[model samples]
Target chain A: MKMLGQKNNRDNREGLKGWLNPLRYGWERVSYWLQRLTGIFLLVYFVGHVFETSSLVGGRNAWDTMLEMTQTTWGHTFLIMVIGASTFHSANGIRLIFTHVGIGLGKPGRPDYPYYPSSLNTRQRSGIWIALILTAVAMLYGANVLLGGD
Target chain B: MRELDNMTVKSDKKAGCDPRDDSFDLKKTTLRVFRTNTAQGKDSHFDSLVVPVQRWTTVLDSLLYAKSYLDSSIGIRYSCRMASCGSCGMKINGIPRLACYTKISELEDPVVVCEPLPNFPVIRDLVTDFTQFFNHHKSINPYIQNLNYDKTEKIDEVSSSHSHRQSREEVDKYLQFSYCIKCGLCYSACPTVATDTKFPGPQALAQLYRYYADSRDAGKNRLNIVDDRHGLWRCHFAGSCSKVCPKGVDPALGIQLLRSYMLGISKDKRNV
Candidate 1:
């Protein structure tokens, strides 16, 4: 709280810049950062898609022009990114649901010296890898669809 | 490598079974310590001091050495050359860690960067204000109380009788979390605390679980304390709290487990 500190006290809160730096936080934070990023990107794409589809109100002429715009090389690449983001977001979301409910992390016990937290264990970290691999596979499939349909 | 022999004797490898920096080779290393004075309206700056180090010379040792010889104005907080006191927490090489616990040789870097712990207002130099951090811990009612007792009631008596005896399983539930020395390293390492000021950091949230899981603390009515938008719900299980914990107290595990109880998905509801 602002009242907690003296007026001269410097607000050293890491803020947005700290949130962007995921390298030191380990894989879970990286996944955390990526999930939020992809979610926002997808939301923007969703809004854009609504406007793109709404062009149909102008009839067949406007619809065909919209289709042509989306068929460009840059459009195809953007579509592939969308597929990748969605796949990663969904897969990681499922993993997070399980972990958030304490499903995958083993039971807490006595902490030995040189403690390694079980929540960040190999099993949980592997979930991130699985989501990434799934994202890659979906992106490749999307690339194939865009190329083949052309 | 300068005046001492820095050679590695190779042996059969299980995991890099070799002796590198095995001897306590005397070397001079620089510690780029963060310096600032909010009182005088000074901005954050680095004061790099070259200190003589051996294989086992800790960052704290180098810091104190620098303080005594290089710059008496350098502000540092330390107690117990060992890590038990939790007084010397700072960002060492971009990670919030206990300077006393971090050895120069183990870091394998000649220049050690020491800065104030992130997400906390730096009081002077590497020293940070822990008033809010401690307040967050206190907000969770970090002690056992009767189920009938409410927050308004005075919990002055910190009692532990045979009636409060816990089973082995009950002890195991929160024993690991009990190892927390309140170093504030985990709080500094938390990503949620970086931006969300109202959200109780991993340290406080972990203590919430520690008390909740304990069979003795039946203050289950207090569970909703962190149910707000800026509460435990804000924690997306970043797990940085566990990774940078100097004492191995897994705040992240406590958080997720607490979430299970809050979500009504945990196998046993008695932990409340």
Candidate 2:
């Protein structure tokens, strides 16, 4: 079957700009991209975490050295990033759950000219706001813990 | 003359223009339209043209004006200039909108960027090939499959039976989804369809749910049709399909309801 938007050689001239056009979309699209990105980051981090923790099998000295490396500035920054991704992923996951369960969807209405917002639309917007707020709060707490003067 | 007068009046009301006004407005607007002509071997490019736009001038009207008066080479597919035909679906200022329904004045941007709907093969400037969209829509068997309909009876006479009659409440169940004009706008706006071509897409899946939700439909095995891979599970519920739908058919909501049904959690009263 012929697929739509299958890029030919001429169409292939444009690089990542087509998929990653930052200026062409709205906040919902931004959140969608970020959720995928964070999920990827979490997957990579999970593998690295398992490997890092496996250092304990090499004896107490190896474990101690691995722990020591995680206390530095760069390590703290990486940990903060991990915290942010986890928080955002969890919050957004909740939102996805709500959508999948049809929590906010009621009677579908006619799309008014000039665009009237629906109940599901409002719920999705609030979900994004809540996710953003939770991510902010989690990031700030992580930053305070890592950057605080002892 | 009378028919033309009636048409003008009806179109004016549909376009949200004052019917009393006979003269077209002289206000000009900038349109940055994507242009491509494979037959002419011309590379895809953005062409900007300034055209006079009235308060009632739709995006489709502006394109028509540009084609007729300014550039004759530009290609666009449109018919029935009303929203009913579903032929004028395009990305107006990065949103999948029906060109016939979108007013030029309503767009807040100074320069309106017109592009072909995303996730579809561009045939030319603002023209997309909808063959695959229709194929996928057809794959789901969109018609109401009444397994109980006796082939021995005349087709029209089958409705004479009182059992085939649906209550007002039963009609209300799938009534919202019956409004789908199959514009492919939902397919364009769907992020899943953008990446995964194997997915049945929002339009098809929504139609599947529409038929499944109908009380008169005796297709009890319908739920299992979309239960396979790249079906109900592929939709991530980005909600873009519902948001950009010109007809207000919330395909995202339909997909979610289908998902809930699959998971045995749907509150929908319809028995499978």
Candidate 3:
């Protein structure tokens, strides 16, 4: 995040076109916070999962009862949110990895100024398309599951 | 008495003068150290203390005194009291350095500032999570690979001259960086490692280059191992790692060398 600040803060703060015009800063913060939050969430989930699995020490009945409670409405809904957040966090992390190493999606001959173009080419826009597609699929599945269709 | 190297105070008496005429008292100094714990919930606050500073007193010495006398539960880590153990590294006045090696009296101000090493999870006051550092070190396979199989045949030791000649400069490069002690000061100082965990880090990358430089080792695929986007490419040459290295090992140079090696810019890429 400091690296981004060093390179982009001047341009980042100067923009006033619209709320969406300077989306990179918002996205960067969101991704960072979400990744950290999701990581903590996963850690908590792991601890709870291990504790729940320890119910096997009691008997098969305990394990079955716990499983039934976990498959209840609230539990299922929480699981869905976890899956979605985890996936988004992972994708954003990978993207960050690429960007940090100077992997520009733009062509080699293109000028480096004004990092993002006014219009993105097919290659430049592929990652966004992929993320949108994945989100759409996940939303559809989530609605289906909640509607008792899956 | 002759003045010791790096000593700031001078003896008042000349060669034949009486010692009783002059007196020396310890200098009163204030230390400002960052304070936090799990119960405190990450809102780090500063705590200050005044102590008498002597010529040979180290920052760690003051910290120890504070912990034992001032506050027993002031969390910190230390192993071998000497700098060899590397467990006592932290940020002193915004620079990551071994606390054991830094003298308290030499600092510009008595108001000493301290913080946990950056680029790592802080466990408590001065104690940081070194799990990531150790894991990265292990990832490079920090050992000699034994390839020869002998049922009965025993091979004589290779000539030291041959091995020595090949790795002379390479050994110098490795020898300095190899003394990292896993203290993680370089990792803390490095901006690249701070932002990107997958960057292999300056310490690990230096060790990576060390393995590639070994004459006994044939690491042909070394370049391939760390050539990815998450590897050498992420280093932006901030030079912070070199600035704070307690062992005087320039990890920034190692990362640069690795980058040049990956980009085919150096003449001795194979030799690293």
Candidate 4:
């Protein structure tokens, strides 16, 4: 029994358009891309955060200067992006957890032509919507605080 | 009958006109078909042809029309001309779909971009080699295995007695999974399969869980087959497989159910 050796000849390459076009495949694919994108963003931000805080090793003056720069509009905007990414990542992560644990899915059903979405599909879609809504709410709150709106 | 008579009258008006005349007023849509000759190692190219778009015209119908009238050499594989046989799975426009099931008019775009299903070796224009797919499917031992039941007994004796039975609830557990037609669409739509060919795709893994969930099946140890590096752990739950499935067999959900089962959570308890 050859476990795994075959190589597909045709280029299955999903070009730039394939990655960019979220509406082509529907919400589930969009959610997958968004989850990956948010994960990368979070990872990069985490590394930057560690480095920024590590300025304490540069002594009191450097730490004070670094802290001062964070009070500016640019810093606030960057922080807002971080908050947005965090909100999306956290909410989507919960959705992923539920999916992996088989929470929303019911038993499989016969596929009708033209393809109707199952109850599980609908629930998972709603989960993406809920995550988007949470991200929006977080961005709004973050903006308000950072921009001195209230 | 009235609509048919009206259509006849409309065609009768253009009886003397050239068959290929654009003045016939037939609704036309462009079919952008992917063409290739792998035997000659010719570079793949898109051959776009304008096909008559009737109300009931499917993607398969358009391809067939193009093949018969426009280009005889264009290659495509189809049988049953319906969704049941699972022969005409392809990427229509961009999403994986059954060519026979997708109506040309239903597409949002006027130009229908037809390509062979991704994540498989293309033999020609629209025909893909399903050898790898079958190999992966066979690896999981898709058939039911009752280890406790002895098969060496006389067939007549087994027939005389009532065989092992299952309750309605027990049957329901694996019934949904039994609907798989092995179209390879779910595997084609999978991102994991595209990136990692070694991963036993959504189609096979779903079948694995299907048999495993059956009350009559004695293959409790079958979970070990999928628990390894290239098996169940590789699926990141992209959900593309489930999304593009023409049949409503949710392979992604099945894999998740299998995951929960492996984690020592009972199937009934995992749903909550």
Best-fitting candidate, scored by DockQ: 1
RMSD (Cα, Å) of model 4 = 4.3
lDDT, candidate 2, B148-212, per-residue tens: 77888876687675356777767766776788898988888777777666677889998988888
- Model 1, which residues run further than 4 Å from truth? A1-10, A148-150, B1-24, B147-162
Docking quality of model 2: it rates as acceptable
Q: Write the per-residue lDDT of candidate 3 for residues B126-239, one digit (tens) a residue.
A: 787777677777767776443443334433434422333543554554555566677787777664565565666778887776666555565566566677788777665444
Candidate with more favorable, higher lDDT: 2 or 3: 2
Residues forming the 10-long window of minimal summed lDDT in candidate 3 chain B: B10-19
C-alpha DockQ of every model: 0.54, 0.29, 0.01, 0.45
**Alpha-carbon RMSD, each predicted model:** 6.0, 5.1, 17.2, 4.3
Tens-place lDDT digits, model 4, residues B1-272: 99997777668656733345465555799999999988999999999899997666899999999999999998888899878889998899888889998998789678999999888788899998888898889888888897666688788877666376776667767776788888898888777777776778899999998988877777766888888878898887877787777777778878988888877666542131
Clashing pairs in 1: none
Number of the candidate with higher TM-score, 1 or 4: 1
Name model 2 segments beyond 4 Å from true: A1-27, A107-119, B1-25, B155-157, B267-272
Error of 2 at B255 (Å): 0.6
The most accurate candidate by TM-score is 1
Candidate 2 lDDT: 0.78
lDDT pick, better of 3 and 4: 4
**Model 2 CA lDDT for position B62:** 93
Q: Work out the TM-score per prediction.
A: 0.88, 0.85, 0.56, 0.88
> What tens digits encode model 1's per-residue C-alpha lDDT throughout A1-150?
212232322278887888778888788989999998999999999999999999999999999999999989999999999999999999999999899888899889888887888899998999999999999999999899897776
Error of 1 at A19 (Å): 1.9
- The fraction of reference interface contacts (C-alpha pairs within 8 A across chains A and B) present in each candidate is 0.71, 0.20, 0.00, 0.42
